[model samples]
Target: MKLLIEGGRRLQGRVRISGAKNSALVLIAASAISGGEVILDNVPKISDVLTQLEIVRAIGGRASWTGENTLCLDWSGPLEGELPYVHAKKLRASNLFLGALAARQKRVKIPLPGGCNIGSRPMDLHLKGFHLLGYQVSMKHGFIEARAGKIEGNRIYLDFPSVGATENIMMAAAGTPGITVIENAAREPEIVDLAGFLNAMGGRVRGAGTDVIKIEGVSEFRGARFSVIPDRIEAGTYLIAAGISGGEVTVENVITRHLQPVIAKLQDVGLDVAAGEDRITVRRRGDLLPTDVKTLPYPGFPTDLQSPMMALLSLARGTSIIVENVFENRFQVADELKRMGAKIRVKGQTAVIEGVERLYGTQVRATDLRAGAALLLAGLAAGGVTEILQAELIARGYEKVVEKLGALGAAVRVAGDESGEPGAKSV
Candidate 1:
C-alpha cells in the first residue's frame, strides 16, 4: 500500500516504543530448538517476525498467540521436508533458520534469504560457523542445504562482528555436545537478549553483548517465558522524527545506553536530548547543523540509521559527509531522497550531503525498512503533500508506524493506488 504524508507540522506526543526487531527475530528462531513450549512477551506485531514464525510452523513447530503481544511456540514436533523459499525471500531474517534447523533436525534445506535492497549481506560467516560445529554446508538451486550427523561443540571465531553469524552459531551450539566458544562475537544487545531467552529454556550460554561468547551444549532443551528488550532503533527513529520536525517528543520503554550513538548524533545536529530512567526526550530549539558521521557496529553510529540521518542532514546548515563502513549497498535511499528535493551524492561507500534550507514534498518509494522511515520523516518535514509507495516494507520491522505518527500529530494516512480503499489496517 502507498502512504500520503502532508508535511509542514511539528509532531509532538508521547510515543511508547515496541520491542526490538533485531532481538525478536533471533529470539524466535532460537526458541524453536527448545524441546518444550516457549512463551515470548512484548513482541512487536511486525510482518518480518510473523513471517519467521510462519517458517517455524511450516517446519512442524506449533505457534499460537497467548496475548496481544505474546506468542507460545512448540518446536518438538517432527520436521517438515523443506522451508518455503517464496516466503523466506520476503526478508533476510529467514537465513537465521539455517543454524536452528540444522541443529534440531540434523538436516535442513532453506532458500537463500532476501530483504531490503541495502546491500549484499553474505552468509559466509554463518556457513563457516556451522562448519565449525561439524556440519556440512553448501548452496544449490538457490537454497542453503546443511546436514550433520550430530552437532559437536568447538571453538569458532568470526572474522567480523556479525549479529546473524553470532545468533546462528549460538542456536546450533544449544543442542550440540560439549562447550562452544565464539571469539570476536557481535556485541549488539540483541545477541544478549537471544542468549537470555535460550538460557531461560535450559540452554547454557554466557558472555553475550561482548566480544566473546561461550555456549555449553545439551542433549535436550525446554522452554520458559521470555520478554524482548525495547527497540533502540525505533526509539532513535522517533527521536529523529521529533528532531527534524522541530518538535518535543518523549519516547518510552527503552534502554538509554542502547541509543547513545543516536542521541550523540542528534545533539550534534542541534537537538536537545534528555535521558531518564526508561525514557528519552528530543527537542529542537533552532535550525539544525550538519555533522559528519561514520557507521560502525554497536556503540558506534549504526548503519541502520544512515538513511534517516541523511534526511535530517538535508536540512542542516552545512555540508555533511557520512561514511557507511558496514553495509556496502546501504545508500539505496539516496536516490529516493533526491526525489524529495534533497541534495545527495554517493561515491562508493561514502555519501556527501549538502544541506538545503527546506525540502519540498514529492512521491518516493521505500527501498528498505529504515529507508522507508527516512522518507516518511523527510515527507513530514517537507513542504506540501508527500506520497510514499511500497510502505508495507516498513511493517517488516516496525509496528504501527502510521498510527504512531498520527498520534504524534503528523498528517499521515494510507491510501490505495487507483482504488480509493486502503489496505488492511494493522498495528
Candidate 2:
C-alpha cells in the first residue's frame, strides 16, 4: 500500500501508544522457553510482532489472542523442524530464537534473517555469545545449524552492549546448568521489562537496567502473565509531529521518563513539552529553533529517532548537525528527504541539514521502518501531497499509522494505482 501525507496544518488531538516493539520482541523470545501457557498483555499488533507469533506457530507452537493486545503462547507441541526459510527471512528478529531453540532442543537450523536495509546489522555478537555457552554452531548452504552438547553457563562479555545479543544469551542461559554473567550489557528499559517477565516465569534474573547482568541457571521455568510497556519511540515520533506541524498533541499511555532525551530536544527547539504521569503534551507556536543532536544508546538520544529528527530539523532556522553513532546506514532516508525538496548532506556518520522555509511534496520510498516514519512526517510538513511507497515498512513498526495521523487532523490516506481489491487504496 501507498500513503499520501498532506502537509501544512497543525495536528490537534490525543494519541494512544501501543506496547513497545523492543520489549515485545524480547518477550517473544522469553515465551519460546516457557513450559506452560505464556500470557502476554498490552502487546502491539504491528507486523513484526505478528511475524514473531507466526514464527512461534511455525515451530509447532500455538498462539491465541485473549484480547486485542493480549496473546497466549503454548509450546507444548513438538517443534517439527527448524524455522522455515520463508518465515525466517522476513525480519531480523527471527534470528533471536537461535539461543532459545538451542536451549530447548539442543539443536536448531535456521536460514539467514532479513529485515530493513537500514545497515549491516551482523549477527557475530549473537553467534559469539552462543559459542561461549557450549553451543557448536556452523553455517552450511544458507542455514545456520547449531548443536549444544549441553548449555553450560559462563561469563559472557559483549564487546558492545547489543540489545539483540543480550536478550539471546539471557534466554539461552536461563535453562543452562550454571551461572551466566553478562557484562557490558544493554541498559535499555526494554531489557528490564524482559528480565521482569522472565523472573515472573520462575527464572532468576537481576540487574537488567544496569551495565552488568546476572542470570542464575534453572532446570526449567513455567509461563506467567506479563504486560509490556508502552512504545517510547512512537511517543517521541508523535511528539515531534506535534512540534513540526505547529499543533497541540497529547501522547498517552507512555512512560514519561523514557522520553526525557527526545522531550528535552524538542524543548530545546522552542517547542512546549510537558509530562504528566503517563502522558506527554507537545505544542508549537512559532518557527522551530536550530539544535544539534547526537544519537547514543539508552538514556541518550535514541538512534531510532535520528532520521525523523533529521526531518524535523530540516525546518529549523539554521544548520543542524546530526551524528549517528549507532547504525551506519541509517542515513538512507536523507536521499528520500532530499527528493521532497529538503536540503541535507551527509559526511560519514554525521549529517548536516540546512533549514528551508518550505518543502514541496514528492514521491518517496520507505527504505526502512524509521525512514518510512521520517518520510511520512516530512510529507506532513510539505506544501502539497506526498506519495510514500513501500508503506509495508512502516507497518512493521507503527500500528495504525494512518489512523493515528488522521486522528491528529492530518489529511493522510492510503492510495495507489495498482490493481487490487476495492478500498485497498484506503487501508
Candidate 3:
C-alpha cells in the first residue's frame, strides 16, 4: 500500500477519536477469563482487534460484531490445546491470554507474541508475576506453556512498571480464590479501563491507575456491556498534525484530563490549544517554536506520541531534543523524517532535532505504527508530494486515517491498497 500526499495544506475540521486500541485489545483478551457474554462498546475497527477476535474464536470462544463498533464475546464451551500460532504471533497482546487462560484452564500453550519492532518487550516481568500467582510458567522452542491447578492469588512486586505485565497479572488473579496485590503496577488509563471491565463482569479489582492494585477472586460472573475510553494517542497525533499543518482543528470524544501532558507540550511548541469538556481544539498560525520533550509513563509524555511530536518539531524554529525513556528503537522515525528534508540526529536513546524552515516531500517508509503517523504529518507540511509505502501498517492502529485526513482538507489519497477500493475504506 502507498499513500500519496500533497504538501502545504492546513488541516481544519473536527475529527472524532476512536476507542483506545491498547484498552480494547487487553479487555478482549481479559473477557476470556469470566466466560460470560461480554459486550464491548466503542471497539476500534482495526486489524489488531480483528486478529484478537480470531484468537478468541480459535480457543472455542464465541465473538461476533454485534454493531458497527460493538463486540460480543462469550466463552462457555470447552477449550483445549495450543492457541493458533498463526494468529497469536501477529499480535503482542496475544501473550496477555497466558494469564487469562491459565486462570481458566489448568494448562495452556501459546506462541510468543509479536508486534511492531520498536524495542525489546520481554515477558520476564509477566512470568514473574504469574509465578507469584501460583502458575509455573516457562518458555521453550518459541512457545510458552503455563500450568497450574486451582490457581491462588499472591503478592507480586514487578521489577518495572510494565503495563502488559500488570494487566496479565490482574487477569490471572481475577478468578482465583484469594486476594492478589500488585506492587509497582502500571499507572495507565487503560489499566483503569480494564479494572472497570473486570468489576462489571463480577471480578473485584481496585486501585487501578495507581502503583498498587488489588484483585480479589470471585466465583461468579455475569454479562455486562462496557464502553472503552477514547484513544488519547490517536487524538495526540491529530493535535500534532494540526500544529504541523498550521491549522485550526478540534478533536472530539477525548478526555481532556488524559491529554494534560500532550496539551502542555503542544503549548510549549507554540500551538494554541483549547480544552473543552469532551473535545480539544488546536490552532497554529505561524512557525512553531522548538521545545525539548521526554517520553515517560502515565502523567508524562507518552512514548506512543513521541514520533508525531518529532514530526511537528521538525518544522520548529530551533533545536529540539527528545529523550526516549521507553522504547529504545523509538527514534527509528528520525531517519524517515530526514528523508523529507528535516534535520535530525540520533544517538543511543536520544534524538537532537534541528528544526528547519521548510521540508521538501519525498518517499519514505513507515517502520512502525507511530512512525507511519509521523511520516504522514511530515508529508502534509512538505513542499512537494510525499509518498509513503506500507501505508497499511498505519491502519493497524489508526482507524479511517485517509478518510479522516481527507475530511480535514488534507490532500491525501491511497494507492495500491489491498482492498479493491483505492482508499482507507478498509479501516
Candidate 4:
C-alpha cells in the first residue's frame, strides 16, 4: 500500500494514544499460560496482534475481540506444542510462544520468527534462559525446540538486557515448581506491564521495572482482567510530529513518566512541552535547535523514536548527532530521508544530521515501522506532495495512523483511493 501525503501543513489538535504494541504481543502470549479465559483491555487492533490471535486459534486455542479494544482469549482446549510456521514467521513476537507453550505442554517447537530487520535478534539469550530454567533447548531445521522433564526454576544472568529473553524466561518460570531469578533483566515499562498482568493472573512475579526480576512458580493460573499500558512510542511520534510541523498539539492517554527521555529531547530542540497527569502538549516556536541524542534502554532516548526525531532535526538550524546503541542497521532510513532533501551522513552506529532551511516532498519507501513514521512526519512538513510506498508496514506497530494523523489536520490518504481524500481507504 502507498500513502499520498500533502506537505507544509501544521498538524494540530489532540491525538489519543493506543496500547503499546510490544506489551500487547507478549501479554497475549502470556495469556495462554492461564489455561482459561483471560480478558485484556486497551489492546490495539493491528496486524501483528491479529496475527498472534490467528496463531493461537490455529493451535487449538480460542481468541476473539469482545469489544472495540477488548480481546478475550481462552486456552481451555488442548494446545499444540508447535505453532504453524506460516503464521509464526510473520512476526518476531511469535518467538514468545516458546516459553508460554513450554509451560502448558512441557515441550514446544516453533520456527524462527521474522519482523523488521533492524538488527540481529539472536535466540542465544532466550535459549540460555530456558536452559537455566531446566529446559533442554535446541535448534534444528531452522526451528527452536525446548523440552523439560520436570518444570523447575533456576537463576539466569543475561549477557545483555534483552527484553524478549526476560519475558520468555519469566513466563516459563511462572509455571515451574521453584523460584526463578533473572539478573540484568530489561527494565522497560512494557516489562512492568507484563509482570503486572502475570500477577493479576495469579502468578508471582516481582521487581519488573528493575534489573533483577523474581518469579515464583505456581502450579496453576486462572483467568484475570488486565489493561495494557499506553504506547509511549506512539505518543512520542505524535509529539515529534507537532514539533516538525511547527504546530501546537496534545497527545492524550499517555503516561508522562514513561516519556521522560522523549520529552527532554524535544525540549532541548527548542520545543515547548508540558505534561499534565496523563497527557503531553508540544509546540514549536522559531527554528528548531540541533541536539545530540543517544538511543539507550529504558530511561534513555528510545531507539524507536530516534527516526522521528531525526526527521524533526532535518529542519533544525544546526547539526545534530545520533547514536543508536540498541540496534544495528537502523541507519537504513538515512538514505531515504536524504532523497527528501535532508542532509544526513551515516557512519557505523552513529548518524550526523545537518539541518536545512526546508524539505521538498518526494517519493520514499518505509524501510521499517519507525522509519515509516519518520517519512510520514517529514512528508507533513515538506513542500508539495509526498508518496510513501510500503505504507502498510506502519500498521504493524501503529493503530489508525492515517485516521489519527488526519484528525490532527494532516492531509494524508491511501494512494489511488476514493477521490484522494484524507483518511479515505486507509487501513
Residues 322-375, model 1: lDDT tens digits: 999999988999999998889999999999999998899888999888999999
lDDT of 2 at 365: 93
* Stretches of candidate 2 exceeding 4 Å from the true structure: 416-427
* Over 4 Å off, model 1: 416-427
Q: Point out where model 3 deviates above 4 Å.
A: 416-427
Candidate 4's residue-wise lDDT over 62-116, tens digit each? 9889999999999998888998999988999999998898767779999999899
Clashing pairs in 3: none
Q: TM-scores, in order shown?
A: 0.96, 0.96, 0.97, 0.99
Candidate 2, residues 241-300, lDDT tens digits: the string is 998788999999999988999999999999998899899999998999989999888988
Which candidate number maximizes lDDT?
A: 4
State model 4's lDDT.
0.92
The prediction achieving the highest TM-score against the true structure is 4
Candidate 1 structure lDDT: 0.87
Considering summed lDDT, which 10 consecutive residues are worst modelled in model 2?
A: 418-427
Pairs that collide in candidate 2 are: none
The 0-to-1 C-alpha lDDT of every candidate, in the order given, reads: 0.87, 0.87, 0.89, 0.92
